[model samples]
Target: MATSNGGLRNMTEGSPARHIVLFALPLLAGSFLQQLYNMVDSWVVGQYVGDAALAAVGIGFPVIFMFTSLFMGLANGGTVVIAQFYGAGELDRVRDAVDTIYTAFTFSAVPVTLLAVGLVKPILFLLRVDDAAYDDAWLYLTVVCAGLIGTIGYNLNAGILGGLGNSSTTLRFLAVAALLNIALDLILVLVCGWGVFGVAIATVVSQAFSWLYGLWYINRRYPQIAIRPFCRRFDRSLFGQIMGIGLPAGIQMSLVALGAMVVMSKINTFGKEFTAGYNVGYRLDQLAFLPVQSLSNAVTAFVGQNIGARRLDRARQGIRVTVVSSVVWSLLMAALLIPFGPNLVGLFSDTPAVIDAGAVYLRCIMPFYAIFAVMFSLNNAMRGAGESMFPMLDAIFSLILLRVPAVYFLANRFGSDYMYYGIGIGWMLGFTLSALYYLSGRWKRHGSLADRDRRA
Candidate 1:
């Protein structure tokens, strides 16, 4: 059972493609469940609450996404560090890295929570959220921000386990959370008429439950590592290594969100129909591209473990396999989306104008989905190699520098039909750079800080 969990598996010796596919399956499932958290809430609110409520929820996302980017960076960094340590049979360091991440999240949670709650209104104003949607947006945003700890906790736990190649366990936890979220959504929104507030409550409660379960699982599974007294004895160097990899990741993610916010702000000028269409289409885009994103996580783990085992060849081979797999899955997704794009968009809104806007966005973006797949695969592989700094810069250049500028330029000339075009262009540029860097083989020397520390 432990072996099957991937907790003790030596990925360096296995067939790279098989291991990657096996690892990604559970991650893919977890991603679906994760998306379900928001989807359930949106579905219930759209059906029971009203379009204004839905718009409020939608408008609040950029704020939520921006704040979460920091923690995600730390989590992703910790995941790679732990995977490398595990791959190298450095179990002690793995334990230390996990504890360090928990410490970081615990320390940041309260301050960030307070800040998010306090600034929610101002941020919404700055985004130019419509007056009609302001109050409901305030309610949903405040509640969600107050519960940031739950979301941070779950991501940290899941990320560490995933680094150990134990995505299956996280999948189980997410499944439970998704089920609870659905039940809560139905009861709170449909029966009790709790509306948007109920949706927020359901999401928070379900996420909190998932975090609790992960805490229990981690404690029982690795009893040797103490989970309490999180920052009992902070190892500055070790923490530095984590932050070294994580901060850039955080900046990269935040920059991307910032860019999206900029574009969203621009879209807001066109009024609610365009906003609704863009936001709804973005949700479907996330779901459509989920497979590639999941595979990116798989690639990160594969590369980290292999590099830690001193098997650069295997790590490179894994990237090759991942890129091909992601491209194929993306093409399949594009095909499915092309046929039923409008019908799927219709699920979120019955209004013909909103539906038309969403369908146009999907059709323009779906063909270029493969570019995103390649970009993620390469970036994640580089991240696993401890070459995170450059990748972060690359992402910012692509997502922010190129993508945002292109959006405004295209929006002015071609109208909303071209709003998503910049994203495709960004993907192409990001992939080209990442691929070149990888082919240069410069990352070979950058195994991981944990390995370097041990050698020193």
Candidate 2:
């Protein structure tokens, strides 16, 4: 059983359903709050700075998510390995996995950081960012990218903590950082009149602080999970194991983000008002999925630890709870978004055309949120069991393989409304395919938590 600070119940030591919920609550809350924290940047900027500024932030997100996605993919894979190793009582292997994730991702992070900062202008131009908003987008992306490593570090460390069932600590740390972000956003962006640059700097500053805090927590309370400096002391076999898992996971996110970038390019062709409206709709959708996102992450660790412990039934139970709970929240949110669509979109833009376009997009896509919930949870569950290829496949089929083509052809045929519908349909396709794959009883027999322990 995994133990942190010398003695702690492994996260899945009880009834699977109850334990899953207990473990997930803190993470769920943190996820919601963190999403809220993100919303603060847009809300503050949109309300105070103006539509162009808000649009710039929106344009910057895909680029930022693309950079973070690389590290995040590695971290997702690392977290799965850490959980399995921790649950299996392989402390040394757990340490090794954590170290590999820290080292490899950090090395990759530095170059990506430089690239994001240096190439922000050309990158945005390639995405068709217009002259009016290019300056703000470049400014936002540059400052955020400057501290990208700090963001990556904090996420990587937090992944380690989550694997160890110490997610409550991550929740608190993120809460503190999010609060600081809110305060700084108000002071710098709203009160001080620094604009988008201020919001960007504040985000990076808080991320740096969180990175330090996470590192401090690991060193003080969980030294075993501490990542050693890279040297020949690093084990090649274990490094390979972590990378084997993480690379596909990272590719999964990259594909999804890449697809979004493609769609954003299409949205760009519609002119600034439409692109701006799409941004509003997308941000609101992100906000709405906060609970499911947090729960999906929790599901990964929960399923991983349980599977590591040889509790197959329990893993399935946790996944069931994930599906049902996520669907419930999704239904509630979709209802809210569909009805109050204008109010939500108008939060960003006062113009009627932009508001109408955003409202239509939200109404078009809201119902599929439940299917998205399923896809998110099941993909995480699969990854937790050390099967990452499905997620990559899921992202590929939905986004690149199918989604891109669907949007392109459908947009040409039935207008962009069909393009919006295409995203939802493709998501459903992936979700349905993944569900059938899981039910086929393959991932279950592939391995178990007990099997991992025996290997150790």
Candidate 3:
């Protein structure tokens, strides 16, 4: 088991805090840069293409998300499985898991791509996209959905790398793609007058490049786990192991996506200004949320690896450290955004109404960031420990049972301002559920003989 370059990090050793922090820094940067792609799209469109265009692109987001949610869930599942096996020093199982996910995604992406492209019109209609921006939304969704394979490809490789405790590789690829996306967005949209079409093209091309780079790097560097073509005797057992964890993760994400679409439908009925403002605020929300998200992702890998190494105590310690770190980070971000949220909102659009509405949403939502941070940190640790069901159920109960109804009720009864309050309520409920689950320690006994067999 030799390390190839610095792409392979073994997190089953040394101080948990130090390793998790180092691993997460790259991930944080990568996620920020990844979010930057969207922020840039919003900025360019708002400034050049008009606010209607900005709102249109924003409307298309949930549609694309619903399609990709399954793949992302599977990728997260595959990552945990790989991280555990890597931790256990089971190179053969690692390779099999990698290939199995690759094979699965390869077969799934084609249909999803076609289905997404075909369903764009009805999906947009269902979201109740307004006539003012319908054309722009349709164009963006069509192009982006058509490129689903690129998204699938990059995430598949990135998940495998993360599972192997190699956030640096993912960062490097994303960094390159991020820079390329920015330049492309500027030139194609601002200079070439490509509008939403240009923005979607820039994203598709950038994602494809990232995917190609990841594929090449994995093959050239870690040939042991490089995904080779499927054989007649494909490992069905390993496939089951990956999907067993991945499917629940995927279903949870899709359910969340569905909730988002439902919420978006409610938002759209408020008309274009609210839609534009919400999307702008949501972009900033993701940016502010990146630190916790990155830490949670790092914890998944950290826990998986340690669990694989038969170091359950170390995995638990990593989660504790990450939760503390994520809370501090969340608080700092919330404080910075709360008072000056209007100024940040202004960067996307010069419309005073847009800025005011977006700022209001941000100010209302920022204070509650820590609650979601705690929920994510604990829940991701569980997923890393191969306990995806509890986290999925928490999401189901919180978002579907609580948040969606609250959002619709508030938006229709009180106003859009009241709708933001639902975020805090949802976070509290989810955090409580995840914390209770973690305290129960059911994740500890969930270990499998297959994991030990891999090590054997």
Candidate 4:
């Protein structure tokens, strides 16, 4: 809480090894809760709606990710920009950056939310959901997309805190959101018999609380960063700069989402039993992925803040420390998940066939957890240092250009289970390329956003 000669600041300007972890700890907890926020819905639906409905919800997952990806890119770009402003000792600009992020969230969420609402039926049709899944998938996606307003606020505020190096604040919101979601999930599905609609309703309501809490915290604690809605007009040059950074990130995420949608389509071909299996596997894996991914996020914030201060060497060292730590963490997770896959996946299904299917998906995919740790840690570090292009391109190449096509070609030989291999191989290629880009020291040669701060 106190600042000494060296302390944990919202904007860390120096790379102190211990300090970075300290800053990251709260975020790790929060990210876990955010993952829970998602999982609670599936858990509730699984317990109540049966496997077919659960598979329907699972089929909607990539579309949800795709819709949210734009908001995430905006948040990511704004966070890095604001972190650099803080490092440059540009308080006014830092405040303006936050305002820009808030505005961006509003405008961006409007069209996306409407599009999601409008296309709900057609999109479900496109995903190839069968007769059994039609009603449930339609209900779930409509409700979730309706809550984009809430999701927007949470994403924007979290990005602000992350940029400022207080991932704790962001996590705090997630905790509240997750708790709210859990309560509603039980009430709606178990008590009210709402089933699939219950899960979506619970998530949206929980997101509302998360968003409100974020808005309150930022306005109360960091008044300097709060924007007066509609009063501030957009600046074209700044807007362009924000998009220039975020667009590639968005495209990258879209490519990944597109690839996932394709994979899900393949699973759909195997019928609801296999699709249910993939859904359960995908949701449960989020539990393991969050730890490493959250740490990667911390790495980005730490690296971004320090890089802005011209502490390039320290930034690189932070990546080294984070990558090594994530590997150990991920391996432990895989060990636990692989052995207990049946128990974990079974929670989502009562039918023995669905349970067995889900367990197989988890066991096969859990082995590749370490590669994800490596991928996220290294990729986020690159993005934080403003070297996002390579990671973005690599995702496109691996996820779409390679994995999706492979899933279709190998679907027959490898059987329905081939979907797992397609995703794993894609990750391996992405991780290798990302690590290579970082080690090549190409990030250093590209000239950084940090350089602009020095001149200013």
lDDT of 2 by residue, 123-179 (tens): 787788766777898899999989998788877877877777667777777887798
Model 2 weakest lDDT span, ten residues long? 1-10
Task: State each model's CA lDDT, in order.
Answer: 0.82, 0.78, 0.86, 0.75
Off by over 4 Å in 4: 1-15, 446-456
lDDT of 1 by residue, 53-83 (tens): 8778888787888888899898898888888
How many collisions between residues are there in candidate 4? 1
Best by the lDDT measure: 3
* Winner on lDDT (1 vs 4): 1
Structural similarity to truth (TM-score) of each candidate:
0.96, 0.93, 0.96, 0.93
Q: Which runs of model 1 end up more than 4 angstroms from their true locations?
A: 1-8, 229-231
Candidate numbers sorted by lDDT from highest down: 3, 1, 2, 4
Question: What order do you get sorting by TM-score, best first?
Answer: 3, 1, 4, 2
- In the range 214-248, model 3's lDDT, one tens digit per residue, is 78877887767766635323568777777778888
Can you write out model 4's per-residue Cα lDDT over 96-143, one digit (the tens) per residue?
676666666666678889998898888777778877787888888898
Query: Model 1: which ten-residue window has the lowest total lDDT?
Result: 1-10
Weakest ten-residue segment in model 3 by summed lDDT:
226-235
